[model samples]
Target: MLDKLPVVGRFLGGRVADDAGWRRMEALLRKCERRPVYRAWIGDVVVCDATLARRALLDSDNCLAREPSVWQFGDKQRVPAATVTELNRWLHGAAARHDVDAAARIAVVALAAASGDLHRAALLAALDSVADMLGFDCNPELAAAVRVYIGDVFHAKLVNAPLDDAQIARAQGLASRVAALLTTCDADLPAVLRNDGVLTGAARGEVYLHAVLSVVGASAVMLAWLACVLHMDTVAGVDTSADSRAQVFTCKPEHVALELLRLWPPASAHGRRVLKDHQVGPVKALRDDDLVIPVFVLHRHRDTWPDACAFAPQRWHEDPRPAAFMPFSAGPGACIGSQFEIRWLAAVVRQAATLGSLQLVQVGRSPCANTMFSPPRCRLETP
Candidate 1:
């Protein structure tokens, strides 16, 4: 019923996440293409031009960031330097804590158990790795709840939307639960992350959610998309045989990952609140106004990328990484886990190639209904 009203369906979480949803978003964006920046259908100022998009992202004075909200990015009460340092250390060391091949094997079992539900398989696989890093046993129920709370409740907080009393209660409950779980764990933790008064109270939960959830969410979506693209390319004859697929994964996993990010970024669009009146390109903004940059449109802009819409990983061989490439966003609020996630995805992709040829069990998008634009559902089978 809501599908008829794509806009309404999308906002209310009824829109199907698929090619159709993307086309709808594209059509909305096209209406504003003539202007470098203009008010979108949702009333936020949209930046269409890549140059201006960069300016909007980089101009710390003109806009306030929404994420890394715990420590506040581009706002008063900045994220602590020590916190940042420790966090980076923990993230960088995560790879050394677990075996990538073991995670891939877990993913394969998860996929079969889920009947090809890519998100679940990916989430379960990520849980194993994160558990290893944080020195805890994988708790599927807790992991799934964290994913849900982040996607549903915490997202509202990011946007500064008012939650009802029930929602507020739920948020507090989940945070307390998460804090208790992490703080009381007896496993050996990384030095900086050790529970010796290092992380406690809400701060403890905030850091855990930020780091662990980020990995879980990113790994799930990226691996799912990796599977989707492999299957799609195989069906299209771009990957003529299993050997050819394996060759691409073996030789150029990073390039393929980059291409995937360009074509189907998980965070397809990002928004910021206009702090004060400012001019960016032709657009003038008043204080408290909202500005949105549709990374999806920017990636496929004809003027910015040659052969814009094609899923050609080989382009990375000659094409320099464009400024418009912002799968992890940009500026002060950009995802800190971006580099680690990319390398992790690449590692997992290499292992995936050895599993088997992929087949498209289902094709669906999650962006319309969720903040993360995860790829369609698919299956992996030995050919």
Candidate 2:
């Protein structure tokens, strides 16, 4: 029934991680939240409210585990389970805590190197720096391969399309080279990775392979700071030029960051598969194989956040809803690196403020919707 309306179906089904699509998704989520669980004809079941999103995420009954297709790239291959959990522990727990400050410093250096309209290069470099802490950024060749393969696949997945045969083959070949590089590279790495006995020898190789290869997705978090800068300027009704930097920020950088993270998180959705028949809040999702919680829609819920879609930093001080917020998600599966990403976000904003001003090159445009930002191409200048 819903699919008949081309506009409505596309609006509901589209991944609105990009800036332009966020508002549309936000409105749809608001419209749909009248029911505890909403069904969309465009794709899968969606939960946009905070209460339901939280329950679905922290599902203790094990009714929900990660959707199988998430780790897939252009080829739709299954990432080994051992590889996923190990990288999660190493990247989220070990690397995030140890390297957040380094990520912050890298962000500063990468930002300073930009001369014209911004590109993904700086953000990629900063993300690569985070990878370095994990020993993935060492091989120049492997790093280059990761950039192409990871970026190509992540962008394509949003449209529900896989890359072409040639693209897939290139990614596969590069994946092999990268796997070899990571496992064999002599660079000193984290102790967890060094703990050879934690993994079987073959699984150990795959662990490092995924660690280095996946860095592209891992690093895309910094782009949220771009959205943060643009969002603040739009809300404050000020220009982001050298003379107006003072007017652009109404409060502390952290406060601005918190609000933007609420509205425009780097990662926008979490998906889980139902093991069997189960109920989550208002929705009986057990019938559906896939249950999706959209953080983009979840954060701005009207019931959860009054004045939900509006940019109001002051709300943080007044609201008791912080626990309801899910920028890093909720439950046992929540992102370990969230604090690390937070540091990168806060530091980016503060640094931009100190640098004088920033203005997106596409003045009237929004970024393309994807997992990471199209990392807005912008120009930052000094007064």
Candidate 3:
């Protein structure tokens, strides 16, 4: 994991932290894709082949451990199975009660009214909407705390950078704050988290913290991407009106959302710690080596996807998904809220169609890969 350090990346291979480094890292991955598995840098091994990547990521018996980060709260070891189980439960419950169209409408309205960063507005709207779906009151301060954690602290971990002392302190404090907020705001939380005594003490708090992060963070990021895509399409002279959206995306709104995610997944790569010596195909990995699955490169694998780089929702009409597609990751560690996110994003697409023409107030650019694969700071303008 020390290979993620910018200095190590500068001397060894390529960096993955900022835009300049991300470009080099991505190119390095593409060049190395011919090898099924190879050392990416000093600390990590790259897994490029789809089949090997799946086995490395999905198989429980493979003896690979999840990379520990701030996501684990104070544990700094591994994500607890109980936390994942409870997170899935809470998100699924919210999905069951959520009115997709209504939520989309509200989010779009909030985006339109955004005075500054549309991404932040979309996130706040998502946080509030998820709270409403769960029958809880949304706290503005909590939303701010979440934003700080996602953008500053958690993002550093995602990009494999070290967090500062202030950031580390904030991460701990934020966990406690989220736990207290959940207990106060959501009545069903106790029942959902109790998990037959499995979740108590710090474990319970960890689960609570992740629940809000997953629901609010993932939703807002995807929604921001959706807006960026729509705005670009409109600027490219593609009509984005209701009737045209129906014709352009003949498959369904879900397909459109899938296409957007495929083009710009939020997380650039999924990482795992090799717990034991293993070989997938021709590449052998030793214990403690970091195995990285570059999600962006895999999504664009030419052999698996025809014209792999284009944004074509119609391809989904033929086959909604290919085995290589892993926007949320794969297997047990994959986000359980993926389906819920897709449904909500599809709803946003539907609502956006009614707005006719959409434009990005900021200059058009490729998705930013700093903290995550995100859009440039921009606002949405409907006309």
Candidate 4:
């Protein structure tokens, strides 16, 4: 079983805790993709071929692959026979539910970012209360479990505390109350709230937590990256007020997040089992075989992104990248929290750019990538 697997297995189970491991994984994929054997696999299953990856991402019928068992049964089913059908259904339903929560989370984060301290506290508490009603822990058990699984799968050392039910419950209650208050005021809502798909009854607390973590964590990383960019740009000793004009650009945190997605995406790869025999590129995929799509490689394809590895927010300034940039993925299996993540990240960046000076300092090793999603590590000293 995944839980019983060694450290590497646990890490692969998606509980990544640090940036070093993530970088290592990125390096490994880069190296592997260059080899012919690996390229064959990439072309056949991993979506390294730009055309194939895009097609698979956009065409629902061709891309409709079964969900991985880990998501449905957790680490417990790693040793046993698990039904792909059940896993697929669970994943689809979960993704839909997550999308709705994502919007709400983004709204709360944005409101907090724009408001005064008192308003921020009230909004945060309301958000916590809603989370409690939905059973989401701010610090979730799934995150920990995913971490342990990733550690075991990747042979990486685990580096997070076990899930704390009491703390999570308390945090949820506090957040929901704040969220409710924020939503009660029409002036505080984002434009997305008026859309049909923006909110759903499926907005449970667990999904809300996931949405919050996704946005907050991504924002934290982009903020670090932004500081690095600012420092590099100012190396010639130009007087750059970290606050004024920068705030204008900062308000669109989604833009910063889009850049981060292009740089170091949260998910490196995702797997789907072929429901029926299919051919991708020159390789034939058998039914029940897993097709591993490497988002890292696909995102960095030179054909899709010029200077693929370079950090350039200007790309988003031009146009949204094609479906090939599957940071949140595409099609039916796409990440539900994608929109919320964009909103939350934008809010965080805007806040930092407007209200405070953000200095990125190395705090400790980044969390080990024990989960499928890896968040960077850095300390932001605000002055």
Top candidate by lDDT: 3
**Candidate 1: pairs in clash:** 17-365
Provide the clashing-pair count of each candidate structure: 1, 2, 0, 67
Cα lDDT tens digits for candidate 2, 269-337: 666656777766665665446676677666766667777766666676666656558766677656655
Candidate 4 lDDT over residue span 133-229, tens digit each = 2223433543333222222212222233333566444444543433343333333123222222333222222232333343333333333344444
lDDT of every predicted structure (CA atoms): 0.59, 0.53, 0.62, 0.43
Candidates, ranked, lDDT: 3, 1, 2, 4
Residue 358 displacement in candidate 1 (angstroms) = 5.3
Instruction: Please write out the lDDT profile of model 3 over residues 1-383, one tens digit for every residue.
Output: 11231232232211333445455545755675577567755757777788788877886786687532423645564455665555566668877787888888887666655555555666666766665664444566655665565555654543335666887777877766655555555355546454435455445555565666666666777777666555544412123444534543465788888877776676667777788997766767789887878777778777777777666677887885766688777875676577878888888877765433545686423334544555555666544
Alpha-carbon lDDT of model 4:
0.43
Residue 134 error, candidate 1, Å = 3.6
The better candidate by lDDT, 3 or 4, is 3
* Segments in model 1 whose C-alpha atoms lie over 4 Å from true places: 1-11, 15-21, 60-63, 66-89, 92-116, 138-172, 187-203, 233-251, 354-360, 363-369, 377-383
- Stretches > 4 Å off in candidate 2: 1-27, 67-85, 96-99, 115-119, 150-162, 188-221, 224-250, 318-323, 354-359, 373-383
Best by TM-score: 3
Candidate 1 lDDT over 1-383, as tens digits, reads 00121233343432243444555656754654566677655567778788788778877674664444334322134446677666756666765555666665665455434544445555655665556665545555455557666556744432223478999778667756766665555655444344536555555555566666666666766766666555554421123245544445645767877877887676667767777888877767767877777777787777778877766677788878888898877887666668766767666766665434444565433333235555444444433
Residue pairs in candidate 3 whose N, alpha carbon or C atoms collide under 3 angstroms: none
TM-score of each: 0.74, 0.74, 0.78, 0.54
